[model samples]
Target: MIQDNIDTTTRQPIYPLLAAFAASCLLGTLATDIVYWWTADIIWADFSDWLVSAGVIVGWVTVIVALIEIFALRSARFRQRSRAYASAMVLALIVIALILATIDMLVHTRDAWTSVVPWGVILSAAVAALVLVTAYLSRITDAPAAIEVTG
Candidate 1:
């Protein structure tokens, strides 16, 4: 039934938002790579450099997923599905951020950590978490009204 509701929406911006998020992440990562290449001797051969690269990739993926969820939540259709997706994305992003942060802390010193942790990654993760929490709470509040209307 919910699937049917989603298909009936006149317009959906979720896909485009997701695509934009992905593009932004990719651009950010590439920029990071280029900066690292120009400023330092690291050339993806070093283990720590590789780890930072991997973290950037994963962080971008998580942010893109979260943006998709946020777009879904704003959509007139598929509110429930949107909330679910947002919740899932939030959980996934948190886990990924924690893992990446841990790896960075253990592998790099304070100075290195400051250089390795991309601001884009942190911003995206934070936005995703905030959007997810807001959407989830709204969905929970609306559930009773939906039930009452249907019953």
Candidate 2:
């Protein structure tokens, strides 16, 4: 019995988890903005503010980890699993989301009603859309690679 070239190096799952969490928070912020718009409540605005802040922070962490993975610890298996173009697109989308979320966080600092009524809500929606697209691209990029064993 012979053992072949089986690479057992497993990549950390923290980046993807953080990415998803950040996306969830950002998307939830959009929902809160909608609720605030419908109800004209200050509490909903506060929720949106906190959510966007958290999302931006977590998104930064996700981006840092992704950058490290891309430049520092890119294993052959990871390269095999991901298409270079798709991975680049995912990173680009995440960065775009981060920028939008940062802007949204600043917008949240305005008066409660005015904060989330228009610009805040619009930024939230844009960030949410970017994160959703990032998540989709990440999923496709992480699909298991087809192993071709030749003798």
Candidate models: Cα lDDT each:
0.42, 0.76
Which 10 successive residues of model 2 have the least lDDT summed? 142-151
lDDT of 2 by residue, 4-98 (tens): 33322233435766777888899999999999999997899999989999999998997887666555655444455446666676777778889
What's model 1's TM-score? 0.28
Query: Against the true structure, whose lDDT is highest?
Result: 2
Instruction: Score candidate 1 by lDDT.
Output: 0.42
lDDT of 1 by residue, 1-151 (tens): 8865555453333333433343344334434534554566444214344444444555555455544444434434334775445545545544554354444433333244344356433533443444345335435644211211110
The list of candidate 2 runs beyond 4 A from truth reads 1-10, 77-82, 143-151
Error of 1 at 124 (Å): 20
TM-score, every prediction: 0.28, 0.83
The numbered model that scores best in TM-score is: 2
